[model samples]
Target: METTFKDFYDTLIENLECYAGEYESFIDYGPKLFKVLCDLLNSDVDKSLRLVISAAIGYYVTPVDVIPEQTYGPYGYIDDIYLSSHVLKMVADVHGYGFIAKISSPDIEEIIIECEVKSLEILSDEEIESILAYIGL
Candidate 1:
């Protein structure tokens, strides 16, 4: 089945839960994902759109964040949304509409939404500010 942006986001967050225990795994997986994202950016897409997607991916992978995962649980998934939407938008802009037509399962979407909502509730203002600073916002 085709995965939706939400599904991908949840997977990224769930994988991140291993940041402490499976640091090596995260490190290993990151390069491969980064390559795929890079390929998407280098496709026949417009340069401006590609640049935006590249920037979003860079921001998503960076340890710095607008919402730190340590404080926000899965709401950190927002970073994934930011990245994926930019990619999808670029694809549509260059390839045409109906690009990225595959939607992820509803279950995955719910998990991502739940995690984001819970994280938002648990994270403090100070922590959020720190995260934003880390992300250079």
Candidate 2:
């Protein structure tokens, strides 16, 4: 991965640890994630960034999920953190962090920050890879 990707990953991971099980976190963050996705997808960013942002949003809504949200209970959001991290890397790589501020969702940006702070922090590379493969992203 590129340096920017690494930095985003590290930052997100640290933040995720802090937000893992807050109240309403799942419902709050999920829509916020998709809202940001909508903002990015509709932005003037390059086609590649649009595709990545779309994939991340798609991953969020897919019913046949990788980790099966019901099975993991609240912890299911770990995958959410990963997807958010993926979007952040793509956004930072193509447009830095400024575009994140352009999202129109009422609380999506704050929700994303909360998601990062509280998302599952112990996911393994192999586990995440399994999810990506399961989702075919």
State which candidate has the highest TM-score: 2
lDDT of 1 by residue, 97-121 (tens): 4332323222333333343344445
Best candidate, lDDT:
2
Q: Give the alpha carbon lDDT tens digit for every residue of 7-30 in model 2.
A: 332433443445545444453455
Off by over 4 Å in 1: 1-36, 98-137
Cα error of candidate 2 at position 17, Å: 20
Q: Over the full model, what C-alpha lDDT does candidate 2 score relative to the true structure?
A: 0.59
TM-score, one value per model: 0.44, 0.63
Candidate 1 lands at a TM-score of 0.44
lDDT of candidates 1 onward, in order: 0.47, 0.59
Model 2, residue pairs in steric clash: 15-116, 15-117, 16-116, 18-117, 19-117, 19-118, 20-118
